[model samples]
Target: MKKIGIIGGMSWQSTQTYYKAINEGVNDHLGGLHSAELLMYSVDFAPIEQLQHNHQWPQLANKLSHAAQSLERAGADCIVIATNTMHKVADVMQENISIPIIHIADAVAVKLKQKGIDTVGLLGTAFTMEQDFYRQRLQDKHGIKVLIPDAPHRTCIHEVIYKELCHGHVYPDSHLAFMRIINELHFSGAQGIILGCTEIGLLVSQSDTDIALFDTTFIHAQAAVEFALS
Candidate 1:
């Protein structure tokens, strides 16, 4: 198996999920005692979060690029930025490293295409939802239509992700709120829902929604495992 490098700990909460999912996926594929060959460089989310709020993407990119370089130096065969929002700097990280940075959106897009899902409802950090980096990639590259919650709902979703989910605080009210938002999107013609934030899977799952739900954390990790084993 190839060594899979991860730049994680944006919150440490979702990084845990990535680690679990990747190992579990490898074990399920290869059977008993088999697991992923992994290397991880976890960052403190405080500084990164501040940089994002300040709109200092250059500095943020530098920080993530440095992390990717460290993983490459440690002999990682490929890289996974464990958070969906952090993928804003994926190109910068890839430019600074030799190994591949498997993108979360691209992984999710492939699944959507395979399932014939043309339009998807996206829930993530404000940047991931509002920015062109993610939505444009899916629309332009894969011919997928991406829809996001409206202004009010988007604010609620973003706040819940940072203030609650990222810190591992999952409340019953939050679950209800998310379901309401998902239902609204479903009515708005969203064929499926993309849990674009890594921590979101903790709050909502396929069982909670009637429409198809795509957990980016699982898709990203599964893609990494496939690349590693190939």
Candidate 2:
């Protein structure tokens, strides 16, 4: 198995999800007690969260890059940053290392293609939603159309991601809010809703909505496990 590195703890809750899913997938695929061989550099969420709140991309890149370098030096073959918003600085993180960065969007697109989802509604932080790196990659590289909730709905989604999900908390009200967003996106033109934020699944889930839901966190975990095993 390949030694995959995870740069995580953008919120520890989602990082734990990655760790669990990766291990479980490895075991399932190998048909035994196999577990993923991984190097994890878990950054303290407070500093990263502060930078996120301030829109300080440069500082975030520096910190995350340093963490990536450390994981590389510790013998990780490739890296996966566990949060979607953290991927904003992924380019910078990759620049300082020889290892591949298993980008979340790229992994997500592969699954979307497998499912034949042409148009997807995205739920992520404001930066990830507005950023070109993610949406453009899905469009240009994967030939998929991306949709996002309208401004008001996006704000509500973002609030739930940060205020509740990050802490491993869930509220029915939050799920209901996301259900509304899913409805809006489906009405506006989306074949499925992609939970672009790793933590958002803590609230919204497949059982909660009628629109097709693409859980990026779950897909990302499955992809990481596949990469490590292959």
- Summarize candidate 2's per-residue lDDT along 1-230 as a digit string, tens digits: 89989988978888998899888889898977778998999998988888888989899899999999999999999998999988878888888999999999998898888888989988898878888878888999999999987788778877777788888888888877778878888998898988898888777788877778888888888888878877
What digit string (tens of lDDT, one per residue) describes model 1 on residues 56-76? 999999999999999999999
Clashing pairs in 1: none
Candidate 2: minimum summed lDDT over ten consecutive residues — where?
149-158
User: What are the per-model C-alpha RMSD values against the true structure?
Assistant: 0.7, 1.2
Indicate the TM-score of model 1: 0.99
Q: Give the residue spans of candidate 1 off by over 4 A.
A: none
lDDT of 1: 0.93
- TM-score, each model? 0.99, 0.96
Number of clashing pairs per prediction, in order: 0, 0
Give the Å shift of residue 51 in candidate 1. 0.5
